[model samples]
Target: MFNVPMEVLFKVWRQKPHQSPQLQTYKLEVQAGNTILECLNRIKWEQDGSLAFRKNCRNTICGSCSMRINGRSALACKQNVGQELEMASSSNNGDVPTITIAPLGNMPVIKDLVVDMSGFWDKLQKVDPYVSTQGRKIPEREFLQTPEERSQLDQTGNCIMCGACYSECNALTVNPEFVGPHALAKAQRMVADSRDTEVEARLETYNQGTQGVWGCTRCYYCNAVCPMEVAPMDQIGYLKQDILDRKDAQSSRAIRHRKVLIDLVKQGGWIDERKFGVFVVGNYFRDLQGLLSLAPLGLRMLSSGKFPLSFEPSEGTKEVRSLIEAVQNHD
Candidate 1:
């Protein structure tokens, strides 16, 4: 509460799915400490009852009021009007500010600030994000783990399925089948759980091209927009690394690419570009088709004076190798 209410303009985005959106502005007398959700409720109650959005817990836990406030994804309940006003001030406006609100991106809007999250949920389902229960008789006891084993799950298990990461995902904007950041984040949870017995099979499916973790662009937008600090992109990276540690990592080209790069860098203090393609795509010179595919590109690079014909160890190569060795030993 404040001594007086400040008048700020709310530029809200209005549209239903498959319909043209309109910018509807409301002039409201609000206090500095008001949450965006509170302002929205006031607008709906006092001015426009038809303005549709979603809300449940009103606290940050439920995440129902997730939306774009000023072109960034955030929970309305967690952000106060005073902070937004400060942002407006810092933007060099210095005057009474206009705040813009819109629905989350990369998902179809149902109406106003609400979006259809069916695609988000569908992608999650494709990951099979649970430990398999087969091969064990039901015991009258809970599966147990030490605190160390259980701690790995706590970070990912905090996800609320808010669809925040999925909405801002760069990969989903181009490739529709790309398993979203949210799904992969949760998938990492299952992968790290000590009780899960399907690591190999799960990694195999997750390696499928453009359908699983391989499809992520690693733009890290998923990490930035996630209100809960789920760091979906980091979890996806962890899954990739864990997959590579398994015996079957080399079976997938994506995994092979990552492994080969690290190995080459470790051996030579940097990549020996000549061996990179053959070792990775050509499967250690075993895949004739992969070698044939690279021949044309290799010729073009050679002709353009861009191909590496000889390998030279970088200066301080020994030091670099020692650093890498230290990290590996620690891991």
Candidate 2:
């Protein structure tokens, strides 16, 4: 006896007896304030008791119900079905608004909407997420931090580990070894905390192999999909800045690349590939292997006369310098 204007048809994928996945569609009338999680619950409890999905703390705190809603990763508990349907309807794709629910990509699916979280937990463990303070007397009550000191860790603490960001990340698509955004963001949080005295050790932990923070492409997908508005991309940027400030030699390659970019923009209005290659290699003979790899392309550019041998600083140098100074001062 319930009347509603909008109805959602969810095309849910479930595992079969042979371990194959199959899609099953279900239609449900949606109330004004109903979420996707609510719709799934109604379908399971009333229509088919065997339906499978995971949910806890329907208020978006548990992060257990992350799935792909219409090809994008979203927390089902936090996403409003009616609103998303409306948005999809308004799009110019001219397709019917049907929610396609699937388990998060790049992880093993356990069932209908559940993914094996062992990978996520394992990555978290590798980062050493907890604070490792040096030998210090125990506090009388609890470890206290100043307001300014506490604010640094606030942004990363908001991450609910929803994995939506990881699901959409392009770096993870290409480089499976790279540590995803959540782990790097967590590492940055601890590094910035004044109470933590093991900053050097933490940086070393984050810089291990090509899978560390330095491998991040700074794409900001993590910032977009976060339901709690935690900017993981910003945290990564902070980590990069911290690395540069420390002048770590292992991070010198990234520093050189960034400097090349800045120098190119300052000297000219655009980037010079020839100069960039030189900057990236640093003493051509030292990186003779890399130089040989790019020899063909470098020769083509040189022959084309597109490569500039020398250039003068642009008039915008002062402005760019000021901007860089502002960022450093603020951080």
lDDT of candidate 1 over 22-106, digit per residue (tens): 9998888898888999999999999999999999898889888999888788888888788887776343234657888999888
Residues 75-145, candidate 2: write the lDDT tens digits: 99988866677566442223335777888876777777778878777887777888866535664547778
Q: Report every candidate's CA lDDT.
A: 0.85, 0.76
Residue 208, candidate 1: C-alpha displacement in angstroms: 2.0
* Model 2 residue 160 distance off true place after TM-score fit, in angstroms: 1.5
Per-model clash counts, in order, read 0, 0
State how far residue 15 of model 1 sits from its true place (Å): 1.0
Candidate 1: pairs in clash: none
| Whole-model alpha-carbon lDDT for candidate 2 | 0.76
Model 1: per-residue Cα lDDT at residue 129: 83
Model 1 lDDT, full chain set? 0.85
